[model samples]
Target: MGGTDCGAYRAGLGVYAIGRLAGAEAAELFAHLRGCPPCRAELAELRRVAELLAHCVPAREGAGRGPRTGASRTGLSGACAYGSRGPGRSR
Candidate 1:
């Protein structure tokens, strides 16, 4: 696995690509990217993934047809019929 330094640099690169960095910090991350090949590659992959997810179709309501429990019906049980934790508060 990559070390923490690599992880941090990768994250910084990701943030920089998404325009989340400020003036001096953005310049710093770009400078780091110039010297760090691994971080540059990881940031490219992250950007691709972000682009793909951005275009994904959203699931329709009532599309899921599992057994209807009280929690599932009212969405109060915080468990989607598809086995995902429902929205609202986290457990």
Candidate 2:
């Protein structure tokens, strides 16, 4: 497939990875993915990113308690940015 053709599918990869792509567009992208190694690689990366993002938002401390301390204050700057730390390791 031509680069231009791939460009359109590439643009929608994020939406597709998140299960938001559907109907004819999704079908077309899926078909293209079967034949395009580059696009397939990109889609894999996007899916990984989407999975990581699912954990970015810290779980609520309770209904009215609000967000966790570091998450709200640092805003992905400290612990949140590094993700899970190992045992005895500091952020």
Task: Give the alpha-carbon lDDT of every model.
Answer: 0.67, 0.81
Best TM-score goes to which candidate? 2
lDDT of 2 by residue, 1-91 (tens): 5453788789889999999999999999999999898999999999999999778866655754655555576566445555579435665
Instruction: Give the residue spans of candidate 2 off by over 4 A.
Output: 1-4, 59-91
Model 2 accuracy (lDDT, Cα):
0.81
Per-residue alpha-carbon lDDT of model 1 for 1-91, expressed as tens digits? 2333665556566677667778887887777777777777888888887778658957667754774577766766544533465454456
Residue clash pairs of candidate 2: none
